[model samples]
Target: MSDLTPDRTADPTGSAGVESKGGDRAQYGMCAGLAGLGVLLLVDAARLAPVQSSNDALGPKPVPIVLGVLLLVVALFYAIDIWRGGVGAAEEGEDVDLSAGSDFKTVGLLVVVFGVGAALIAPLGWVIAGSLLFWGCAFALGNRHHIRGLAIGVAISLITFYAFAIGLGVNLPAGILDGIL
Candidate 1:
């Protein structure tokens, strides 16, 4: 629409364009891919050695096997629906901003924030690094309440870190808090 804006007339999935073959194929392909993943999971689970002292008749393989069958069934149903001219419903989430063009600056900032968080995680720990990541993203997204944003970020990150570490037994890097937390 502007002199500086690249002519997006050829961008098949751009705001200027309509229903694209690439997008349609990708949607169906992803459904097939999900089904493939489920099959792979089930196959791999089947290859696992059975528990010697198993009291439960239904072992680990049953869950993955059931998941695989469900995925396959869903994929088939979705394919049939698509073939019958059925279209997926649009997302009604608050994040929808169809009118706005791509905000490259915000995207770039977020990328940098995430990259920095990854680098810092091993040294600073999940709590600290994740907090910074959250705070950086809030600022990048135009949230001006710096203190409130950082506070929320720190709280959420710390909560998630402990949840994964203590509740789920996942070992997130503790770094400086290694001995303490």
Candidate 2:
């Protein structure tokens, strides 16, 4: 039999042995968090000013309302599943070594890179700061081709900057390249 198959012999009642033990109580916290977030979203959506125009009739309220309702539904189903002792199955194909230690050096480097990138955003602009962030992350992850990585990073940053600032009509600080861009 496959590892995924439950052992019926362990429980004559035909339910998972966990049901008798009262299931996992820890998962209830996730359900409660989801429900709370759903309520918050609903409340926020309710507070939005009604917008009626010829171009757009629906406004921004529908999306948040739908999302909030979906979250609540998902939370209810998750709580029910948890009450029935339906725990998630363990991954069969995972190759992680549980005994191995975490690579803190890489993590620390990435964190520092992110912090520097955030600090430089207003001064250097999205293009320069984002390029540095991308290249720094690549270097942290062991990319050896510095010039290629930098070029790719610049391209990505420019694309995102144009996409968000011009295409999507979101304002991004132009910083040093304020007039040129």
Candidate 3:
């Protein structure tokens, strides 16, 4: 308030008359620029003819536009955060989690289930794919009670099938069992 001023001479960057937050600003600026680029790419993709096809009412433009706007919003948030000196302090401790274990059985089972689902989907349609994904994920998550896991998996799969196929009116592959043959 009096004659006291900020000790710019003691700044870490050693720039007595320069802004000391340049590193933080540069880091966030780079991230924001990259995010903006990603958003622009999606916007450009939405402008492509393939995305504007008459195959569907909304076509592919809707999703890309939504995603592009979302990315741009996030980029703006990052830029504002950097401007507010909200760059988090660097951590000095080890944060690694080395206790994780490999589950080869679950991994192998998931691959087999996906393969079977893919082989059957065109005939079985969304019902099979939804069931396979739910079951594979449940088993992978270590659901040891097979009956309970199966019940939950089937319920989720049927619900998803109804949502995607009936509610959303999205056509799923109905493989060898096309037309309920």
Candidate whose lDDT is highest: 2
Clashing pairs in 1: none
Positional deviation of residue 133's Cα in model 1 after best superposition, in angstroms: 0.8
Give the lDDT of residue 36 in candidate 3. Answer: 75
lDDT of 2 by residue, 29-114 (tens): 99999999999999999999999787788999999999999999999999988887777764354788866899999999999999
Give the best candidate by TM-score.
2
Q: On a 0 to 100 scale, what is the lDDT of residue 90 in model 2?
A: 42
Full ranking by lDDT:
2, 1, 3
For model 2, what is the alpha-carbon lDDT of residue 66?
95
Off by over 4 Å in 1: 1-34, 51-63, 80-100
User: What local lDDT does model 1 show for residue 14?
Assistant: 40
Against the true structure, what is each candidate's TM-score? 0.67, 0.79, 0.60
Q: Using lDDT as the measure, name the better of candidate 2 and candidate 3.
A: 2
lDDT, candidate 3, at 23 = 34
Error of 1 at 2 (Å): 17
Pairs clashing within candidate 2:
none
Tens-place lDDT per residue, model 3, 1-181, is 2645445445443334434344355657666776877678786866768645576766666766777777777887777666655544433448776466776887898788778777766656666666666676677768777778777776876677557778988766655445662
Q: Which residue runs does candidate 3 get wrong by more than 4 Å?
A: 1-20, 23-26, 29-39, 42-46, 49-63, 89-101, 174-181
Q: In candidate 2, residue 73 scores what lDDT?
A: 100
Provide the clash count, candidate 2. 0
